[model samples]
Target: MPGKRRMAQSARAARCLGVRSRPGALALVACLMGVPEARAFDLFGLFGREEAPPAPRPDALPYAVRLQGVEDDDLLSALQDASTLYRLRGEPPPDGEGLLRRAEADATRLVDALWGYGYYSGTVAFRIEDVVLGGDAAARAAVRAAEATRNRRLVAVRISVEQGPLYRLRRIAVRDASGRPLDLPARLTRVGDDEPARSATVLAREARIIDQLRAQGHPFAKVVRREPVVDHADRAMDVAFTVDPGPKAALGAVAVRGTSSLDPAVVRSFIYAEPGDPYSPEAIAGIRRSVTRVEALGGVRVREGEALDPDGRLPVFVDITERAPNLLGVSARYSTVDGPGVRGYWANRNLFGGGESLRIDADLSYLGLGQDYYARRRKLAGIETNGLGGRLAATFVKPALFGTRNDLLAGAFIGREVQQSYLSDAAGGTVALRHRFSDTFSVQAGIEGQVGYARDVLGRVDYRLIGLPVSVSYDSTDNPLDPTRGIRLTASATPYPSFLGSDPGLFVAKAQGSTYYALDEDANTILAARLGFGSISGAGLAEIPASLRFFAGGGGSIRGYAYRTVGPIGPFQLPIGGRSLLEGSVEARIKITDTIGIVPFLDAGTAFASSLPDFDEPIRYAAGLGLRYYTGFGPIRVDLAVPLNPDKALKQPPVALYISIGQAF
Candidate 1:
């Protein structure tokens, strides 16, 4: 009867206050198993039902939760059971405002907790009901009723699944900036926590994987997670991604343009690319490097493009701008046989915009030397005979005449030579053409003639004879300092075929061979060897020039005798520039550091003629040491040599000193 009366009172109180309760919020206020009543008051599940709320415990109790201003017992019970406010079994009153505030705060906390679990739109609320005191000590009874509400139990609370399934990639499709398709790897990444695929949410991760593929050579790759079923009733997702692979392009050809000054042949030889070559950024860069190697040129631009023909082949292009030079320079050289030599020139490269290198030049030299003899009976010293001569040459050269690597250098000049011992004076000129076979090979061939006049030491007069000179050489060494790495072999021969009037077509046959070898890892050591043989037969021995003949034993030859002081086909004469001279040097060179080095050498040579001066005589030998310091242009060398035979010397055992640049060979 008491419970029935409490229920009736609760119904009357709910009607009077017009209070409504929500099942979810009431369930939250209600207390479930293992939850304390004092704390359950803050959770709506503490309330048993919508119509009946719990009551607070006694106000005098410790840690008691009380919904204040409640007079009806049944209504209090209803409200308390549905509220989140709860208190200990024995606690003082927790006021109504404080209880409501706690409830609100707990509701907000519940919403936040849901969000923390990926429930982005999750919510919470509190349900309320009015109550009235129903028995003796009705306020206490109402408080107890509220406590009962806070102690209500919750059964079967709903939990929504907020996370979905994972996605795994099936394939990738790629394309380039030109909209060309690109090949991609067949394997794709699986996404989202490594679980089974259940939803299309894996699409985002698939896109990421595709982007990575594109970055690694598959520029146009893409991924699309295709989920065939809408509901995923089978709990399994099969994804398909389409891939389109286009053709791979190779380099088909190379083209050069805008090269007005440089020879196309030269440019072609320097290029690294060839037809049907693979496209390489490095090779394209090499073309630019080739342009820079040209001596007199300007800016170079390189690009890759499709050929003009519809064949759709890619080719490399090089465009060049050529610079211009207007002035020229000249140089001269001299020796005892060629004295007071002088040469001058005028040049204009890039002339008339037709890209022509025109050079006009000339050269001249005079040579004279004599030894003085004394006659005691005459009581006077007189100048005897040695030799004297002069030579003059002129040339006109038009390099790149047809805008190519070939050159035609043609001109004519006159010359004269005087030798008192030979009693001869001669002059000649030449016209020639030189064509560069490649960047490294060039061939020059020409014809010349000379006439000679002479006064001999024996008072024998001879008429001048003319001859032709022809020669050919092959050179391919890149480093001038170490020609041994590459070799230059030359051969020349001339046989007298005419007399003084008609300018002899040939005479004086000669043939020479020179070779070099690079020895060290850095090409710092070199071994050079040469063999030469020639003959001149046109007049009496005294009327023919012997100075133009061969001689051995000099700073550069045998290294033990003064220059040109070695021979004259006799027992008293040192090995004269014989008809045959065989010379060879073996040198050990080392670059001690970047700037300096030492070379120890053994030089041996012999000059001989079949007619006299026993051709089988022992060869003269010299051992020497040299020091070299590298410079901006070349190396400076100083050498000191000592002949193995000491008594052969007039003063200091035949020691020779020399200073020069470049290799002896």
Candidate 2:
């Protein structure tokens, strides 16, 4: 019967489940059941989730510090924090004391969390509430009073090297957005396993490495590190920054505007960028280099502008402004090979519209050489002079040629040169044709002829000789000004059809090639070599011209060797210059800073002639050391060469000093 009654009651309770439980009703049940006070918990109080306790009376007896339990310092301190306010909350609680007690309890909880990492000892104290402000203000005043006393005193923050000596990467594994490895230094490392790692320095280094990678074409390289792990077994710590290299998005399009006579397409060809190519800040900076190369050609100015499309698609625009051309310039330079040089020019690119160029230039130089051989008795030296050199040229170039992809230029020049050798005087004229095959390659060829009078070292006047000269050249460099990578080749040869007076005809031939290879992000080296051969023979139709003999020396030949000093024409008295020539310089370019560099070089060359005196063997030599100053025009160079072989006739030390523009070769 009781079970049935209970079931009925349970059903009724289930039906009344939606009814709200009355606060403290559980306490009434406990009283009815007579549960022991210390062991009992009021279920009604638990389920009701009582509202915040009412604010304590303001004038009540203040809580005191005596509530601290235990005389044992450690236990007492712990209990002080745990039971801080509980002792004041007993029945008949002190006025304001209950509020202060609760404050202390909250404060203790905060202090414990703070000390968890080794701030071993901390204090939590509170002040009695002052009856100053009322309501919320009064509550705040009480809180402040307690907080002021409960302030934590961090006695000693006993700290230990948790897990340090993190060796951060000296450099990130530079990768593109697609996560491909870049041409980075082999010694570059981005992670460290050193003990007692310097957290700050390592972090800073990672940031720097990431920045460097971005500049080098890895735009999306990032580093992620885990909580450092201290390996007690090995007595060392390990730190790592996992790499997340996003795709390397290269420059899509580089567009230029603001030009009339100069074609935008032509300008682009001179720049270093293409669709789907990896993007690089250095490449972007190349815009300046491109503009500088031809700045003298057109009245043009260029500056970097905003990136049009950043989504790895579309072209980037480079703002350019072309000032109408109306300018003139003049310069003079001297070199051992090119001789005392004078250059003056005037240009009007927009003459009569349609990008037509009208330019006039005058250049004059004198080439001379004198040398005495020790073994041969034939003392020989002479002055070879070339004068009255000037040119007239015109061009019509369109930015868009043939409505497709190409650049066209047609120009011509007429010049006269008067040259005098130890035994002859010569004069000549030249005409040329140039064409651009593509952005990477070009071809240029020209024809020249010369006729002049000659007076031998004996001062006997002779009839004029004639020269027929021809040459072809090719080059492919994205940025001609600062060709970080590319190749250039040129070949030329000249044959004298008429010998000086009744003398035999002379034949001379020469070829040159230069190449550059980038080894890494910051370094490149150049290898250059030269070869030449010529002769003079007394014959009729096949006779070699007497004044057309070939000789190598001066600034362009081996550094330590004198001008025209390499060749084999032996057994003649020691002439002042050698006849045959061969020279080479191996230069290593190291970039110390953005705009600074140093080059260490080895130069070796020799000169000889057929049937020279016994002591007239080709002048063999080797030299070392040089400096380079990079400029807007080119690298200005200063070189010092000490001869590996010192001639017996020289009175001073054989150290050659040279200053020049561009590479020696």
Look at candidate 2 and tell me the lDDT of residue 405. Answer: 33
Q: Model 2: per-residue lDDT, tens digit, 12-124?
A: 22222111121121222222223443322322332122233223333343333333312334333323323324322322233333454455444534233222211213344
TM-score of 2: 0.50
Best by the lDDT measure: 1
Residue runs of model 1 more than 4 Å from their true location after superposition: 1-392, 400-406, 411-425, 439-443, 454-468, 499-506, 535-543, 553-556, 569-577, 611-614, 644-653
lDDT of each: 0.47, 0.45
TM-scores for all candidates? 0.48, 0.50
Q: Clashes per prediction?
A: 84, 75
In model 2, what is the error at residue 628, expressed in angstroms?
4.4
